[model samples]
Target: MDTLCGFMRDIGRHLSKPVVMTAEGGYANPVLGFDPAADRVVLLAQPRFS
Candidate 1:
């Protein structure tokens, strides 16, 4: 879990947007931006499917 978090942090820091920590430990909050744009994040307390 630590390693995964580290990687996530690295990715988040490299982006210009915020990467929130979801209730599921970053599940619904995915890394947005497919092209060469600033990355964005969106985290929810619960998964939509749940």
Candidate 2:
């Protein structure tokens, strides 16, 4: 999954750092999201690993 991880890395470069450490911004492929109030963090993907 090197390619996948690489893509993630690239996407990460575009994201803005969260003001609050507990928050995250990654919900789309090549994106990220984290929330302390939610009690979970998820990286939404296209579901197609093509």
Candidate 3:
């Protein structure tokens, strides 16, 4: 996760607009947290497939 955040920061720095990362469609457990320093929201959840 740290690696992902690092990549996001690096990419975000080069871009003019804000960056929002979202993950979808998985059967793993969710990870919920907030990074105040980066002002980033990390959300992980499983997708509902019928």
Candidate 4:
């Protein structure tokens, strides 16, 4: 997770636009903190299929 977060932070340095993050596949491991690079984050509950 550290590697992944490091990559996101590295990428964020070059981006001028606002970064929005979707917390996917992360509920299992549960990262309690939001990414510093993200301007906003969208957290989804477990999926419900019809």
Per-model TM-score on C-alpha atoms: 0.36, 0.30, 0.42, 0.35
| TM-score of candidate 1 on Cα atoms, chains taken together | 0.36
Error of 4 at 21 (Å): 3.2
Those runs of model 1 whose alpha carbons end farther than 4 Å from true positions after fitting are: 20-50
| 10 residues in a row with least lDDT, candidate 1 | 32-41
**Predictions: Cα RMSD each:** 8.0, 9.9, 7.2, 8.1
Better of 1 and 4 by TM-score: 1
List the lowest-lDDT window of 10 residues for candidate 2.
14-23
Clashing pairs in 4: none
lDDT, candidate 4, 1-50, per-residue tens: 67655555555555644333445865454432334445333232455599
lDDT against the true structure, each candidate: 0.46, 0.40, 0.54, 0.45
Candidate 4 yields a Cα-based lDDT of 0.45
What would the TM-score be for candidate 2 when compared with the true structure? 0.30
Show model 3 residue runs off by greater than 4 Å: 25-50
What tens digits encode model 1's per-residue C-alpha lDDT throughout 13-45?
Answer: 676445555444667555332221433333334
Q: For model 3, give the 10-residue run with minimal summed lDDT.
A: 26-35
